[model samples]
Target chain A: MAEINLTINTQLAREILTGFIQSEITRVGFSRAVVGLSGGIDSALSCVLAAQALGPENVLAVRMPYKASSRDSLDHAQLLIDQLGVQSKTIEVTDMVEPLIQLDPDMSKVRKGNLMARARMIVLYDQSEAFKGLVVGTSNKTEILLGYSTMFGDSASAINPIGDLYKTQVRQLSRALNIPAPIVDKPPSADLWAGQTDEDELGFTYEEADKLLYLLVDQRYMPQEAIEAGFDERFVNTVVARVRRFQFKRMLPPIAKISNRTIGYDFLYLRDWGT
Target chain B: MRLQLALAQINTKLGDVQANLDKHLGLIDKAKKQKTDLLVFPELSLTGYVLQDLVSYVAHRPTEEDPVFKPLLAASHDLDLVVGFVDEDSRHRFFIASAYLSGGKVLHVHHKVYLPTYGLFDEGRFFAWGDSVKAFDTRFGRMGMLICEDFWHASPPYLLWLDGADIMLFSSASPGRGLGDNEKLESARWVERINMAYASMFTSFVAHANRVGYEDGLHFWGGTTVFDPNGEELAHGPYNEEALTYAELDLNQLRRTRARLPLLRDERTGLVRSELDRILSRG
Candidate 1:
């Protein structure tokens, strides 16, 4: 089995990401950023980077906890907020999301999880306007590639600092950035329901997925080539299928090409146009 | 001859010609104060890179009449200058070009020959490919200029070396990509290797100026550098930050290096020409 090396220069990654956060945010005329703190390593990393880029006073960390969210999640988030000395707010979304969840008592776990994720997005964006800041996203490359995030939910943001880093790389950077060990060491979860974990639900660990995806996506290996490289056939097939299925989530909404110069087609201009 | 060269590793505003021109003037003023004999700016220093639709609007012809070039040319009287901009032809075709200015006149302009179309770059769709690669005489000596992707290929620099250019000035708006195991980004490592190799192999001085800052999602790592004929690094700008790095080049070293290792004196131009002709004809 050919081992895929996922090790990165954490110091270089830190500089690039922090510069990315600072430049991307300030270029759009905002000196502040609002990050949704999920108490996970991804959010913790993003929040720390935002604090580093724009000073801690300019970053507003919003904690949107559902009724069934774990107590450890809240405490971990508070621990980071205190450690980083950024402005903190805890917005309980029980009132906002419960009314919707009660309408269909038999809602699936996926749907309920999506509701909670989007509820957090809403709070962060609203605080962004009030705080005059941009919403910094926390979705890592693994979740983005696997389509694990809900569209316009946790995936919605003005800028994403850690989106390029995979889940394993996120862990590596979290430790490098001196994030609290409890946040970095905890089992990954969406906290959609009581006692729910991400790896168990996905049926494969992130360690396994990251190595295969790095080959398939980064190295541009074929499915057969990935299997030849010692990834399980079933695992390779499932990851490939998920990546293809979620292609729409990665792109902007398709615009119809009726005019001579359409927005994404002929009227091509960078987002940094006229900045 | 000895020359003090300055690499202006600056961050340019996107699509703002006036603002960028002001920055160039400010830096030129600072370089003049330092008595730099030659000041170099990065690719598209007047107009930022990633100018997809803004290319035509930001393009300028390197003439005294041009609003952007007027001051830049006037500043050349104190010291020689190398600035990058989108050059517009009479036929209205835009080319990524670098102009050498001295004594209040444009000395030479080298249009970028390679338009990178694949991956994150879309230069082919927006601009015309340059067809010529020639070296021109300067007060310091004969020199050649190449844009970002131009030096990536072996032929442009090779042609300049053959054309009696002792100094190679390279500029880029290169983005930082591929995080490696080292402190330097992958792009920086590869570029430095190429610059050093060109200096040693061609036995000429090599200077590179790259921009710093982000436009849209792309982050241009600064790390401007200069290498002597002996392949020793003379000066290096900061990685991912704006800096005006200076390197003093003793042009006498080129004569010394070439005399020690007469790579150019052992001529194989006829052999290379015949082989190239045969290969092309066979194809």
Candidate 2:
């Protein structure tokens, strides 16, 4: 009889990152972590993990909020920085963005969104270059599952601590870590558009959607059976449909199988060779 | 007699064992009505592979306890069937097994080895690798099973062939790649090329069953196909989507080809010995 292998638990996640960071630091002799603290749960969790992995002084939280973003969002960002006792700064995106919008007011929402996401990423990357740190990602499995994240935008991060866990699970873990309550309870939003909520734009609440999806795709429940088991039929079908609809968001750009060794499906990329 | 067998490349979501079983039954009925010799399916088709860590549990429903097997057993009575699912025994570790059914009974089960444990794929974290490599007694002579990565390596099935595996079937859930124009893709051309080379070298028949359709971020490439002893592509399924391509295999050709090639006959037993090196190197 063989024993079951262990997974990456919270303790393990932290331990894995700690060891990885220390080895990387020693290998290069020194390294830091730069995080974009959106005052959101994802970024907050990332910041906390980054602080523990690298020293709080070594962890830099850059808050890049736009002018249209509410004052409460900024306050919440400060609240987290003050509570965590990490080095923080405000790099408001208003000045950087106003010129871009003025240049192309007729540009589509997608174009604007892409610009906004890229702008934040550019700031984080620039800061990371200045401080010689890695950009830690804050995306949860739910966003990654639904292809809800922008590639190279918020989606671009060096190492994601909470990428596998769902949004609800992220909140649960955040509570376990003693993060501020307001951030946990706050309605999740990209703060992408004014008066926008993650749930509203996504057409369902994170709690409602991620669970049903977890059951259907992750748990392998069929449409009728999932509904019989107390999931909304429409919601279950819709979420399953969307996951099928947007399969591209989670994968690397497809390289045709012209050669024998392609990128993902065939070609092997073995980790831990030097180790 | 030549047999035109179709390997049903269907989608199996994680944990929805019942739905996958239903799909199996439906495909079996279709195959039986078409008068096909057999219909093969992907590994873990009953309970979807990549069940996070839940697949690590070594628990299986017995013939009586497993309601999912009921329809499958009934369907197999009408048609020769090969399917994949979770099977458990004394090994506390779970097994990715392929089941061969006939006359309403599961005749044999081949547990998978070479469980992948890297990147997005994590089979080793769950099931214990299969140790045995014996070919089963089939109506079509001695046949063996290699689930997914088992066909990737040279050791396991090569040993099975030495143990009288004239026919080799690989049940897989090979992930799909998408083109820029938004279409499902069948990839891992390298795996097929190398696998076919071994089959041709060994003078054996090889049939590969890959699951089709999308599940979450992963897409199952339905490139089911069969290769003759000469490594010719006898039949190939549609890329990135579902299609049950059928091929007629003449078992008599297997013996005649082995005689013609004489590679298997002319092999030296002592030189390039695999097992002896392992024992000697362990010291």
Q: Give the TM-score of candidate 1.
A: 0.99
A1-104 in candidate 1: lDDT tens per residue? 99678889998888888998998888889999999998888899999999999999999999999889999999999999999999999999989998998999
Candidate 1 wrong stretches, greater than 4 Å:
none
- Candidate 1 lDDT for residue A177: 89
Lowest summed-lDDT stretch of 10 residues in model 2 chain B? B177-186
Best by DockQ: 1
lDDT of candidate 1?
0.93
Q: How would the docking of model 1 be graded?
A: high
Q: Total clashes, candidate 2?
A: 0
**CAPRI docking class of candidate 2:** incorrect
Residues B122-211, model 2: lDDT tens digits? 777667777777788766677888888887888777887787888888889876431211122224566567668877888888999888
Q: How many clashes in each structure?
A: 0, 0
What is the per-residue lDDT of model 1 for residues B137-157, given as tens digits with 9 covering 90 to 100?
A: 999999999999999999999
lDDT scores in order: 0.93, 0.73
